[model samples]
Target: MNQKIKRTATKSVTGVLLSIIIFSFSGVHLPVLDSTADSYFKESITKAGVSYGVCRIINATVSVIKESSLEVEPAGIGLSLAIGQIVDPINDMVERLSNVLVMSITSLGVQELVYEISVTLVPSIMAVVLLLLSLLVWLENDRLVKVQNVLINILIIASIARFCLPISSIANQFLQEHFFEDKIVKANAELARGTVDLGQLNDVQLPKYDGIIGTIENGTSYLKQKTIDFKKAIEITIENNGLIIETLLRLTFLYLGIFIIQVLVLPLLIFWFMIKIVNILFTSAALTAV
Candidate 1:
């Protein structure tokens, strides 16, 4: 009894410390994302025959915009470059990239590890406690054990879901807010305004901006069409990124969740195994006394 009490106390203390650490550590990695995107930005903006990296990202982004109207999180800039999955789901390369990148690409990989584990500790320890308590009475009160186990499982699920779901949602929302949401709207509006301005330009004024002049002599049809096309392309780019970022964030969080479940399950299973042994031994001893 004394040993069990000590162990429980230790677990409680550890859980408290861990929860505090996680609370302090879960800052959003938003700022570094622009740095990550800058890697592609330079490539995309440069002259032709420049970096294939820009083309690669642009292609993916364009595709994404064509597919969805949802926003991209700013920090989820990684997702903007991401492509493939939903359109392809299992068969698509995007799905593979999204999953692969979750661990491989984000700063979240190394940094979030400690925090995620920390967040998981309380629920994990609590899970062990519940399981052990359930085990002791499990054989004697089968109905009670079953009910308690179900409740514990629910708590475990709820805890893990709460932990992961928010992280994923935040990542998705972040990308949407920063990169995709207003970007598409702004880009579309600009393209439309550019069209109207070009239309209103007296034939005399079209030659003022070289780029505009070049586009105009090519005629409004060509200029406006290209503008719309390019705008849509950029929009797609933003959309693709959102999806991939969301996926990566989701996958990243799920891994930690699985870890929490394992921690809870393994200890619970061990305790139950021990309980079975104790029940068996007690039954034998009682018979002998009889």
Candidate 2:
């Protein structure tokens, strides 16, 4: 009991010293250190890129899908006409799929929002919380044990908030390097190739028609031929879908990994560390008592 009291007294003194230092620096400046903690600013920016990268990937995938559908629309007309009633349902289903895909793209925006807020504001908030907790601990409040426990918990949270961005970013880089880099690069290259091919398809010039009647006839011919060409262009787009799916799956995994690291894994790690510290203090106190 005497040793426990001494330990508590030591903690109170340490907390008082920290509170003084924090106050000396001013609370506003307190977070600046944490903001840049462990190359956090750079890593945070890099992490932000993941969401942007995913958005770009999804956009490319959508473009390929659009081109494919457009190209197939005209050339597939004969097939559509032959199928008659079946065409309407197929077209409707395709339209619905397109809509759903576009909607899913919004998830990329959600990732951006989440990463930005976490890296930018959360650490600073936690730093301020740490400073406030220090003040409470220093005062050696009536409920000293409760206040110390809360302070320790806040410290764990603050520490995680300080380091999670950089750690998760490193993990992200490792995953990309070891597992997904080549596949993602190839997928990007494929999208670039498809874009180039689309541009080339659009480059073919139409012939001029002489009279109004001739112009009308030529115009109708032009539309049909363009549709057929579009259909051909779209074939490549459809073929790229497999690659797109693979890239999306990989990107989704990266996103989930990032989320788990920041939201769950890091906090648990901090909690584990705090528990170990508490256990060590308790053990020391027990040994001192004996």
Candidate 3:
């Protein structure tokens, strides 16, 4: 009966994972497989180059979206990060609790906590799966099966943090820059006005006027006639934006920190903890050594 129950649980989990895989890939462009896949969307976009025509096109599309005369998309990028946090083993509990509280109050009634719960639930399930994988791996290992299972669990807990940090950083960046949209529009308008400021219209140096013969009026008129597209000030999402560029640069260090946590800190911590536990359990120098 116990074996049957375990098999049922395993099948259910497999079914759920398969569903998630289908959803993640749904509508995703793959040039080799789908007619809907645009050459650019199907292509890898690490950098701009002659062969990377797709990346260049991507850059152009982003420019259009960001600089849209229409209202911004209200899809709420922070929501995605919230989902990521729930899956994360190393969540900043304090911050999450605050978001949850605010979300609850604003939502109220049936809607309250529904969306929050939806995103947070995904990570929670993923964490359980990872934990189970850790347990199974430990049980199958013979060298220190009984003694170091707890250590393996700890390492698993620490390693999941790798996926969570990227999500949180993405969320945090969106939250910081969402308000800046207004400021960006206003700044672009001001820049446009300043460039077309009619006071210096005669200062422009045209083909007919040069070598100290340029007037302020000439300069102003010259600029007005120039075919610069000031309306297209914004051109990319946060991922490809200058506003989030500095924040992303800092996140580069955070990536290194995760690597350290995974490759060095986690291993050292698990080793030290297991050594102490093993010493206590076996109560013999020879056993601990072996």
- Tens digits of lDDT, candidate 1, 69-120: 2243232333333322323331243344334334332323332353345344
| Models sorted by lDDT, best on top | 2, 1, 3
Model 1 residue 277 CA deviation (Å) reads 2.1
Q: What is the C-alpha lDDT of each candidate?
A: 0.41, 0.49, 0.35
CA RMSD (A), model 1:
17.8
Poorly placed runs, candidate 1 (over 4 Å)? 1-217, 238-250, 275-290
Best by TM-score: 2
1 versus 3: better lDDT goes to: 1
Q: Report the lDDT tens digits of candidate 3 across residue range 15-88.
A: 45654653454334334322211221122111111112322232343333333312221323443233233222
Give candidate 1's TM-score.
0.25
Per-residue lDDT over 1-290 for candidate 2, one digit per residue giving the tens place of the 0 to 100 score: 79867775676567566655544543232343333333433443454354445445445544444454445444344432322232233234334433433433343344345445555555455546555664564454578768767766666655554444444445445554676456545644654564444344334322333567866766677867865754564454345444444444454554455445544575457557666776787689889999
RMSD in Å for all candidates? 17.8, 7.8, 20.6
C-alpha root-mean-square deviation, candidate 2:
7.8
Instruction: For candidate 2, list the clashing residue pairs, or say none.
Output: 71-230, 71-231
